[model samples]
Target: MHERTHKVNAGSSKPRRPAAAGRSRRAAGFTVLELLIVITIIAILATMFAPRLYGNERREFR
Candidate 1:
């Protein structure tokens, strides 16, 4: 009884790899369209706010 229980416990304790492999088999990285969308959003935000911040700096100098 003790030996059987020990074997069961040891088997359960060992990490299983099939489940992990199944999870990682799918595509994981970002697509090009996603990267382009992020870049475009950043560019638009910078354009919208950069001049106002720079203008404030110019006023401080003057």
Candidate 2:
């Protein structure tokens, strides 16, 4: 039986594949500012449009 051989160049530079989403090199968890900004945006939109939504007691929960 004969075995096939394959060779790759060592001198050439190659681009690396991108990481898949939800898989992070760093530890998970959002920064304070980032989370605050997101929360603030949601709050602003909710406050501005909450009245228009039906049911005054409880319209929706994010």
- What would the TM-scores of all predictions be? 0.56, 0.42
Candidate lDDT (C-alpha), each: 0.80, 0.74
Off by over 4 Å in 2: 1-27, 55-62
User: How many clashes in each structure?
Assistant: 0, 0
Write one digit per residue (lDDT tens) for candidate 1, span 1-62. 45543334455777555666865745687778999999999999999999999989999998
How many clashes in candidate 2?
Answer: 0
Q: What is the TM-score (0 to 1) of candidate 1?
A: 0.56
lDDT of 2 by residue, 1-62 (tens): 89998566587566444676436844587778998999999999999888777566564542
Cα deviation at 13, candidate 2, in Å, is 27
Task: Tell me how far candidate 1 lies from the true structure as C-alpha RMSD in angstroms.
Answer: 9.0
How well does candidate 2 match the true structure in TM-score terms? 0.42
Clashing pairs in 2: none
